[model samples]
Target chain A: MVSIRDVAKAAGVSTATVARVLNGGTPVSPDRTERVLRAVQELDYVSNGVAASLSRGRTGLLGLLVSDIANPFTAQVARGLEDEAVRHGYQVLIASSDFDSEREAQVLASFARRTVDAVALLSSSGVGEGVARLIRNGIPTVFVDRRPPDLGEIPLVRTDSLSAAREAVRYLIDLGHTDLGMISGPAGMPTAAQRLAGFREACATAGLVVRPKCVREGFLGTQGGYTAMCEVLDLPVRPTAVFSFNNVLAIGALEAVRERDVRIPADLSLVTFDDTDLFPFVDPPITAIEQPAYDIGAEAGKLLFARIDGAETAGTDVVLPTRFHVRGSCDRPGR
Target chain B: MVSIRDVAKAAGVSTATVARVLNGGTPVSPDRTERVLRAVQELDYVSNGVAASLSRGRTGLLGLLVSDIANPFTAQVARGLEDEAVRHGYQVLIASSDFDSEREAQVLASFARRTVDAVALLSSSGVGEGVARLIRNGIPTVFVDRRPPDLGEIPLVRTDSLSAAREAVRYLIDLGHTDLGMISGPAGMPTAAQRLAGFREACATAGLVVRPKCVREGFLGTQGGYTAMCEVLDLPVRPTAVFSFNNVLAIGALEAVRERDVRIPADLSLVTFDDTDLFPFVDPPITAIEQPAYDIGAEAGKLLFARIDGAETAGTDVVLPTRFHVRGSCDRPGR
Candidate 1:
């Protein structure tokens, strides 16, 4: 094990100077702080807080890891978790991965070191390594929103994005539209893959064939959605209806369409996943699949508390239902 | 400090067994885990992660505290900070305070214990005790958006909300409006107080008296804004124009007016602080005072990195400028 003395020697500083830097904020010279940091990295010193905290037990804190805390979807779910935790006296520490796997691993390791009671994760790039550590450490963990396709034997509480997306496509087909364009999420993410799969399955069941050009994958961001929409629009014999995977994507797609002088649901009906306040207020009032982010958080909290209470439990996969918010944005083709 | 041995003795476990539990996941029995947790709580043991981390140096991490990460205003700023820090290879750990001062204190303490590089705060309920502790401990701390009105010697980077709000009100007044109503945020928050003061100052300068009934204080939440808007609407001789303090409030207030079947700008001119995508997409795109949330975060990150690089600096109050986004929502009021 790397010790304070070793780090001190490597950094060419006194053990106390190293401690001052490590303890955070005691006005150590920047040069000494830099040297100590380098030494710690070289030594690969594991944090002792988790070990120390385990002696104290259940920090009454739950660590939440997601790609972007600023993402409205993530934020809403967090709000639900934060509000519910108050009932059982748990505070949440949320960190953003910014879609980087390495960052996620570092944060997960930090959470474990903090000895949080549990973890609620919305996996960015398959939090595989971090999940492995959490499980090995016996810290209860639950996946939220997006997780790996399968966790072998781990608890997950998330919206059924695939089923909801399928239902959305079916609704559009029933409204008498065959030619449909889809704005898909990035390929690697399970949410994106599932939604695309559902869209294909729905088209297959309806005996309708979608042109390859009509299905475009994007970074699942605003600009990605807009560019994809433009591509779909330029396609010869463009689809009369479009299915955007989520709210942000829908917003961008809608903007692209708005720039063109097209009447919504008359020229092109639009539907997307993820409902938010802005959806209903948009000029045409977009129809969307509500992910029920709050409910997912509430359920994740429930599962976590059960584990913290030492419940002899199975690794349950709690799949919550989604609802389609019908609005003026979708209608019979050429309405 | 309460040692692991003490915890083990209290839990009727051996020192090695206690070590196994603290080190995490080597699999102690559920009964033993329960007993250990109880013992730890009774002993009030804090983990030694900070000591371990300090022995190492610069965690390559920064801590950010905000009232609500879900709040669009807060989230956008976080996005900027997160985006900027990646340039310097620093990751951010953002904790939602949920607008509670107590939670802010606890999170701050944990950050210090974990030995993060520095902290950026978007205060809720004035980061009183926590700021004191951070300063006393020599942690480089900077304030973003909202801080205590008087911190004497702390760096603060925020949008100039007061001047912006005042300018917005003056614009409305100049647009042929004698009477006006306002949906103000809770008075306790410095942001709220500043905006309110700006409005009052503007009214005084215009030689206009604010009717007490036209002013309402909301929780700065959707429902609160809705209720306040309704009250203002029902007042006898209602003001022709309304100024909402921020985006969320504007959303709720807009819904209230939408239900009333009144023509915007003509029946009731509306202006607000905080421009969002929804504002421009709505019917009669909103007139808004755009607070530069991202710029504020970017500047905060810059100030923090400077402090981390060992710049001997005095407390800086960096106030960024706001822009008025004029849209069709405001017109010469009539009918």
Candidate 2:
């Protein structure tokens, strides 16, 4: 329990000078600063973060909530946010919601209780009540990759999923694939809903009927994709091309295809969303809609910090464009 | 700013009852608990974590340091730790060391300043001084994946990388491949040292010559792997088979091989360490030594919690076994 007084005594400096040096406040002479640091180190005097936070009314902590930390896309976003937070001299407290709205709400409540300086959400479930709670607590928040409806003005950084999905589907249609299939994410998630809408728009524009049997809802996991892909394969009139709206789902669908000995592109052209590093190593690689996951996170982090610093950043919606990477996964339909 | 008194009055309960409910202390009646929760929600009451932590001397926060969070193996470990922490009513604050000892030290100091209940380290760099600081501060710690020597029995939960590497190399030898190349991590890292030792032991047992020109060092990254593999390939007498002691390095080596139009398992056999989800999808589906990353994390988390709960777990070293998954990445070296 060594205190600032002990550090000051060891350094032969005043308590005020020690506080200034430790808190990164007004600068002290270089020689004094060196002495203070060395003495603090030798005495092992750790400033009580709790006490400092209580007095300053700031925790120097940022809260980040993600649906799944194990997901590569989510992990990249977290990495970006963490890097940015470190640059701003803040540490991030991360909690996973596991795609459950209740869990998300509980985590948000915990963040509120912790009095985190700001919060960022990549929630896959409904965040209406949880966000309202944050706002009620006067906590600055930013949305990443998911947007809540009617939330007045919370800054958000997200990918243009609709346009990306539309372009991917149109590519398949251009390759003379009149019948198309899709493995969509959970219906309620905003990203999923947008991708699904994009799929419909692409089919309608091409004068192609999107068979209900060909469209299956996936749980944004590999198993969900496997099940949905199997159902699509079992259809009476199978689709010539299929789109899996997420990388994990695409992986599962690929497994399903490989298990059934269905050759990619040759037998059924495939397209996927959210290109990750592993895409290139996969057999035949994958043609994917690449979302700027890192950028989205970095932007959200910047926006949250701006709000925390008392900037009027309400209603700032930053939508980054996606890239269409044409790889070895898709080709024209064959006999 | 909503005080306990206000919530107690609104719920028609005593302030003690409100505090008990909010702090998850002695349980009150279910009816009263329900009323207190409703009143809390209606009034948007948030307990001050900093003030409560100051009084209680526990922050309910666990600190985790990893080399890289974006790596899938690291992410899985983090996910396991987070899940275990959540089950025990604690949250995790994760920081990446990025393989720099200075950064690792800084993060540990911050964790101490914040008074985290416990810490888990997956540090790639020398953590001697950082760990000493933690010990001096009386903070419970568990080592995951990497262990620092002469630490006087700090609990460590890690994979048996040495034996796993030996087995993987043995499999390559049994396939009649004598000349073998390796892409090893930085020399000082414990995991890399152990893996390199295992490779040598296997080669020695097989009466194979260990060529200095064939063994290249990598930085635990894809680019590092690529550079090392290129050097190996440029050798006057290239080895028939190669072992990458890490997954990212193997990815880089694979890329280099692909660029040269050299077919895997035909022109050159390959084996890798750390089997992740993406391994199965990779071209040729790499044969790998699968470390139980998630289990290591979960076990370390359990050990850390036990230490935090005042259990006598000093010097407990838990070494989880690794599994060798034989995939399509390896075969007898052929003309």
User: Which lDDT tens digits does candidate 2 get at residues B1-335?
Assistant: 78778899999999989989987859789999999999998987888788788878888889999988888888888888988998898888888887777888889888777558899988888777778888788888888888866774888888888888989999999999999999999988888999999999999999999899999998877899999999998887889899998998988898889887878888899999988777887888889888788888888889988988889888888988888999998999784
Every candidate's lDDT: 0.80, 0.87
Top candidate when judged by TM-score against the true structure? 2
Report how far off residue B59 is in candidate 1 (Å). 5.6
Backbone clashes, each candidate: 3, 1
Off by over 4 Å in 2: A5-17, A24-42, B5-17, B24-42
lDDT of 1 by residue, A24-64 (tens): 87889999999999998787543433333444455667778
Q: Model 1: clashing residue pairs?
A: A22-B54, A49-B49, A137-B25
